[model samples]
Target: MPGFLLNLNSVVICSHGGQAKPTVPNPRVRVMGMPVTTLGPPYVVAGCANPPPPVNVGPCVIGNWVLAALRVKVMGLPVLLQDSQAICVPTGTPLTVVLTQMRVKGM
Candidate 1:
């Protein structure tokens, strides 16, 4: 199993009058080297401190194998598939990974 190191941050905003409120600083949820299975719905996990991570609400199953797909929220996202076996993303980028759940047909 492979894992990723993520740098995260939490923020809070308060509204007043007719203008938008400022953001309040909170503790960052640094999910360093956490399993991809832990990243899911109801609880969002992303890469950067700027743009939020993409939403993943589905399974990533193919044939009889389950494949994982990571949504990276960054500029010019580049993906490299090594030896047609593994896929990789660069560093200094924020990513939200999703693991596939298996449900074989006629099992």
Candidate 2:
């Protein structure tokens, strides 16, 4: 189980790393059918399926930059902000979040 946890952690890290530097240009992220702009480097929030369309989705970032940018100055990086000011997304729709910036700890 410990090994599984470690692997899972690694999987999460790798996933974040890939998202931090997406090679695909103009990656479209939608929720509940509406388009949204995320705060960070385009991270898909887990388990936010079937969101209302045309919603503003914020991405999770490490203080506006990925851990790669932290260098050695910061002892460790903080987790990305998972929640933001809630916007009214109409029910029964998927929202689209277009990532514009990196989601940092604080807005």
Candidate 3:
């Protein structure tokens, strides 16, 4: 599916509401004036509300993007998009794409 490209400015979060930040944004590609995020690099999560133990083992601390644009590439790696899918480590929860650059779209 085609969707807006994800940039360093894109707002992404884990299922538990933790903010997700790309560990590495591709400097070779820019979208909406920010570096575009690519697959492979893990996203670090912080401030997750999901509690540990009895509540459920969570409070997601890291995320890995497993899916991304099929056609868009930055340095031979697929670029992440608004529709890209990611999973939080340890919790097995998915990341939510809250916002992305509206200027560029990719499959």
Candidate 4:
């Protein structure tokens, strides 16, 4: 699916509402004056309210993007898109794409 490309300024969050920040943004490419995000590095999550006890497993701490643009590449790696899928570590949940730059679109 073609969608807006994810950039450094993109707003992403874990399923539990934790903010997710890309560990490394691709400096080789820029979108909307911001560095584009690739599928290589993990996204660190913070401020997750998921309880860490018997009630639930734990809060989402990290997000690993498992899917990205099929044809878009930055430094030979796939560029992340607004519809990209990511899995949150420990919690085994997903990351949500809240906002992404609409200037660039990719598959």
Candidate 5:
């Protein structure tokens, strides 16, 4: 858990939305390297498959970067954010490093 919680909800006032034009990239906290036991099954919301593709798949839910980012950070550095759910990660603590560390420990 991080000491601070980041609110992704923002209003940029763009002429268009979607990952085009401004195309503000959503920084995805890498969970690809996390331990399998903790990663949990592919998160499925509103009956949609985990990480549903970008398409008009009817009204449904999808991955929440804010939440995922928090999870990744917490799993990587539980000590850093002892009493928090999520906050921006410290400089240089990338997801790859965290997953590598955990995997090494497991082996």
Candidate 6:
């Protein structure tokens, strides 16, 4: 299995807001490497930190370098690291990442 070094702050977790419950610092964060399972939910496994017995919850991270797979999505965006085959990224090129998730509230 391949692995990727990821910044935990860059990953997104879809879940309920803390207004319904007390905030927990650095909740257990996990990820399932992509090409996702056909017709089913993604299978989650340990991605970073020394995980403690797997508790599912909202978004949380202490901002550290953790290992995951390039297939995983970070912050609702694709990591776009590498391919299954060896490919070369052109040097000195400008790249732009466009985020499609926009929110307009509390106007």
- Please identify which of the two predictions, 4 or 5, would achieve the higher lDDT against the true structure: 4
TM-score of 4: 0.97
lDDT of 6 by residue, 72-103 (tens): 54343333221111111111112121121122
- Judged by lDDT against the true structure, how good is candidate 1? 0.20
Cα lDDT tens digits for candidate 5, 1-107 = 22222112211111111110111222343223322222222112232222323643232222212223234333453211112112111111111111122111111
Decreasing TM-score order of the candidates? 4, 3, 5, 2, 6, 1
Q: Report the C-alpha lDDT of model 2 over 14-68, residue by residue, as the tens digit.
A: 2222222221112243223323233333333333333233553332322222322
Residue 69 lDDT (model 4): 96
Better of 2 and 5 by lDDT: 2
Q: Report the Cα lDDT for candidate 2.
A: 0.25
In order, the Cα lDDT scores of the candidates are 0.20, 0.25, 0.90, 0.93, 0.22, 0.22
Scored by lDDT, model 6 comes in at 0.22
Native-structure RMSD, model 2: 14.7
Worst 10 residues of 4 by lDDT: 26-35
Candidate 2, which segments miss by more than 4 Å at Cα? 1-41, 54-69, 73-107
- Candidate 5, run of 10 with poorest lDDT: 13-22
Best by TM-score: 4
Arrange candidates by lDDT, descending: 4, 3, 2, 6, 5, 1
Query: Which of 2 and 5 is the better model by TM-score?
Result: 5
- Model 1 regions lying over 4 Å from their true place: 9-37, 42-107
Model 3 residue 92 CA deviation (Å) reads 0.6
The alpha-carbon RMSD values of the candidates against the true structure, listed in the order shown, are: 17.9, 14.7, 0.9, 0.8, 15.5, 18.0
